[model samples]
Target: MEEAADGDWVVRPITGAATGKTYRCPGCDQEIRPGTPHVVAWPAYVRDSDLDPWDVDSAADRRRHWHTACWRSRDRRR
Candidate 1:
C-alpha cells in the first residue's frame, strides 16, 4: 500500500465493484484512472441479511465521493 498525503495507505481495488469505471480523487478533484492506485475507504463488512441483504451482482460496495469532480467520468443515467 502506498502512503497518501493524508497518511492513508492507498491500495489497489481488489474487488470487481471498482473494476472498470473512472473515479475521481476526493483530495485533488482529478480523474482516478481505472485500475490505478487509489486511496479507497473500505466499508464495514456485514453479513447478508433479509432486511438489507447484499446483492452479489450489484455494485454495492462502490463508495461515495467527497467531491462532484470525483464522480465517474461517464454521464449517469437517471
Candidate 2:
C-alpha cells in the first residue's frame, strides 16, 4: 500500500485462480477474463486533516478491478 495522488492505493496482484466469475474493469468497461492475471486495487486507509476517514474508505470500497495496462494508464487520462 502506498500514498497515491488521487487516493491511497492498495494494489495486489492475483493469479492462478480459476474463479469463473468475471469482473468488469471500470477503466475500460471490459470484462476481466476468468483466471487471468490482473490487478485488484483499492484505497488504503487515510488520515486527512480536512476530510473524513470513513468517507474516503467508503469511496475506496467502490474500487474496481482493472487490466494491468488500463490501471497503469489511469494518470494519463487526467
Candidate 3:
C-alpha cells in the first residue's frame, strides 16, 4: 500500500494477474478491463478526530479502482 502525495488517501496497486473483474475508473469514466493493471484507493481515516465508529466502514465503502495513469495524473487534471 502507498500513501497518496496529499496524504488523504491510501493506494494499492492491483496486478494484472490478480484483477478478476471490470471496474469503472472515476478519473476518466472508462472501464478498467479485467486483467488490466490498476490501482485501488480509499480515503485515509483519521481515528483521533472522528468519533463515529463506522468511519472505517465508510472509508472502505468509498474505495475506488483507477487506471494507474489516471490515478497518477489525477491532481493535474481539472
Candidate 4:
C-alpha cells in the first residue's frame, strides 16, 4: 500500500457526486467509510465496457475492488 498523504486519507464517498469528499453509494444507498468495507456498483469504462477500475467524471474516479464474496456474486450474475 502506498503511504497515505496527510490530506489523502479521507472518509469521502467513492462516487463523483456530492461536494468535497462525500458521496452516496448506489448499492447500499449509504455513505462510504474510508476505513471500512463498503459495496459499490459502478458502470464499465467507456473504452472497455467489460473492464474494472473505471474512470468517472466525478469528484474522484471510481475504481472496482471486489471482496471475496462480492467477487463471487459478480461471477454468478454474469
Best by lDDT: 3
- The model with the greater TM-score, 2 or 4, is 2
Q: How large is the C-alpha RMSD of every model relative to the true structure?
A: 10.3, 3.8, 3.6, 11.0
Candidate 4 per-residue lDDT over residues 1-78, each given as its tens digit: 112221221222233232234444433345544454433333332334323465545422444433324433443544
- TM-scores of the candidates are 0.32, 0.70, 0.76, 0.25
| Candidate 3 least-lDDT 10 residues | 46-55
Off by over 4 Å in 3: 1-7, 46-56
Q: Candidate 3: what lDDT?
A: 0.82
- Candidate 2: clashing pairs of residues: none
lDDT of each: 0.42, 0.74, 0.82, 0.36
Which lDDT tens digits does candidate 2 get at residues 1-78?
Answer: 856678778887777384467999878889998988788887675446325535553536656788888888887866
Sort by TM-score, best first.
3, 2, 1, 4
Q: What is the lDDT of residue 31 in candidate 1?
A: 72
lDDT head-to-head 2 vs 4, winner: 2
Q: Who is ahead in TM-score, 2 or 3? A: 3
- lDDT at 50, model 2: 23
Clash pairs of candidate 3?
none
lDDT of 4: 0.36
All candidates in order of lDDT, best leading: 3, 2, 1, 4
